[model samples]
Target: MNWDDLRVFLAVARAEGLSGAAKTLRLDPATAGRRIARLERSLGAVLFAKSPQGYALTEAGQRLLPRAEAAEAALAEGRAETAGAGGERLSGTLRIGAPDGCANYLLPQVCAQIGAAHPDLDIQILALPRVVNLSRREADLAITVSPPATQRLRAEKLSDYHLSLAASRDWLAAHGAPDGPEALKGARMIGYIPDMIFDAELDYLAGFGVTRVPLASNAVSVQLNLARAGAGLAIVHDFALPAAPDLVRVLPDRVRLTRAFWLVSHAGPRDARLDRFATLLRDGMRAEIARLEASVA
Candidate 1:
């Protein structure tokens, strides 16, 4: 089988649609579709079952997946072995998926500094409100609030960060600060939508007796904006506090919570370029979180 055709097949399988696979491979949608058709003809077997929802792999495709992945890994290993043969800087795209809060507040500076040092490297950050699917190739790397439970992926703890109840100075002036959790009664709370909380780690208000959140958003940035606009008190990441200078922590001692960030990626052969980049990213996150939190403190 043509390796290029297999590569296209792998991309389609991961993306689950021609358009998405085309985007990832930098090919036109028509071209991607034609390639898949050609591959099926050559193999004399159907690879995918098409539906309005998306492409679903056929039994043939399922059987072919492992062999294709092995070939892909071998090619990746070869590339890694020859990477930077002449002291060349890291080039090509590195896409990271992260929760919107971390994506909005943490990654820009860290990625900017990395891009500055390696001018050829292109970085893409997907500020998704849900868990990034590594199996779907949604991102080359993902920064998650909790470690993935799947054994197919590898995860490393980056840093532990804090969150505290905060409200706009204007809101506090009007409503008065809550002395404790019990004092939160009758307060207009801002937080994630109850049923839309995707991860257990994101259910920040669970133990605080906050049964209702009148102002809610799945995206942390939006919640922060609501708090900044004096809508109500919300739990804000300590590293994100500097972005809203008008906001002040309420019940800091009693209502504070701690969480850690995990760097997650597909388990595979080590690539020197990715290793170096991961190191820089990990250290940058530690420093940035410390700096931002200290400024708020």
Candidate 2:
């Protein structure tokens, strides 16, 4: 039997009728019925019983489901692989998903390099709240602080960073920067929630040779917003805070902490554009981190 016939039968079986199958596959009722009829004839067995309600799978149809499903899966995979194989010029669209901070600090340079090297390529840099699954092809490339343990994917460390006790320039000016540990008690503290990895920055709080005024641990992203709005002092990842025109580092010596960045992508299909894109990102980010480190020093 033809794959189309089996596919129509499977859809009809699942959808419960030719009408539903046609709706699902964007086909007409007559077309779906014709294909199903052809498949049953080719198999020399009645695959379905049409009742007033819809199509119900017959014993023969039940037997054929597994084989038909396997064949459909194989065909889909073959089509994806064939479509994925393309030249090394990086002419197609590339989607890179990253956290807000990375998008702010690193993306511009990466975009510039990619644009210059591959003028025909369309680079879409999406700043998302969650990491998309590279294994499932949710994104072409992902930059994250966490990496998954999967053989189907490849990952690499991009750079390391510590947290910074930061606040807006207005907040620091009005509050008067506290220089010593004793002055921190009751200090308005902006913080990331305890579950986040950057919560390590909280370790350096008032008790660790420091005391803050009214300390609180909030989520990092939220804390950044609060800090920017001059709400309180947040221990932000050094890489997370873009150089804000209104914000400034406060109590830098009070919070000493560090973390790493990782780049992740799929290993299969070996998308040449993604490979070149990741290499470019690593190189650019490393240089930017070095410059920031020097400035921090």
Candidate 3:
């Protein structure tokens, strides 16, 4: 039950092998093996079963893994808290995972300002089409269209943006805009590919009583671009349309929908770097949310 031995055990559990764990811990393979053995002996359990494939965790290891990882995170949190007490420049990578539309349209300005403020810190934005797994430490922070329902995670409304059905003026002139909600069923609709709809919120058309989308894509940008190209009518965020003068909202009053972006983080110990960045992000978003809502209004 030595803390050092537990650290070695945790590393091996993650790396799944002695050599990889040794590489990670910067310990010789022999020493790493000895640490694991010591931990196993102290705990009186066969923690891992070695095989040709790798070291697979036994029941004891499986049970201890989460506790050990939690301990590691707690230790890191202590270090981050200590560092936060001093007024030193933060120098580490902060990874943020966000959906495509928000990542593309909202993040550039926010990230630019953040970069200017924290030149020593590297910000990595992973613009993904799907939700990131915060439980597995996939990202330091995530902006999700839907609030996370998972335990040990904190989620707050980042901003509420307006969505509406839109099409290029050229397309509207060519095919004609739908006169009513009933007519929209036959309109040439561009939307997310049915199976690729990661979040239920992205299923904008279904609520409008439209079942068929003739042209579709997994990416929001592609759908927006397709609408801009006069291919079809699309459900798009109002904030993304301001620059594209050709696209016009089809049903200004009737078809409007509002969705909020939720900022989510693991409910682990707080870090000054994360706290500062979150505050910056939150404040910037508060200033922009009104403009975004007004654009549609």
> Which candidate tops TM-score?
1
Model 3, runs deviating above 4 Å:
1-89, 292-296
Query: Residue pairs in steric clash, candidate 3?
Result: none
Ranked candidates, highest lDDT first: 1, 3, 2
Local distance difference test, each candidate: 0.84, 0.67, 0.79
Every candidate's CA RMSD:
15.7, 19.4, 15.7
Q: Candidate 1 lDDT (Cα, whole model)?
A: 0.84
Per-model TM-score, in order, reads: 0.70, 0.56, 0.68
Residue pairs whose backbone atoms clash in candidate 1: none
Q: Candidate 3: what lDDT?
A: 0.79
Compared with the true structure, model 3 gives a TM-score of: 0.68
**Per-residue lDDT of candidate 2, residues 4-52 (tens digit):** 7877876787566888578656799999999988887788999998899
Model 3 deviation from native, Cα RMSD in Å:
15.7
How badly does each model clash, as a count of residue pairs?
0, 17, 0
Candidate 3: minimum summed lDDT over ten consecutive residues — where? 76-85
The digit string of per-residue lDDT tens for model 1 on 167-258 reads 99999999999878886656789999999998999888877777889999998999999999999999999999998999999988898897
Candidate with more favorable, higher TM-score: 1 or 2:
1
- Candidate 3, residues 1-297, lDDT tens digits: the string is 688998788667656788867865679989999999988888899999999898989999989965775565455434434443555656689999999888887777667655665678898989999998888889999999887887699776565578888999999888888887778888889999989999998888887688889999998889999999999899888888875778999878888887878789988888877977786665555445444545655
Residue 240 in model 2: lDDT = 57
Better of 1 and 3 by lDDT: 1
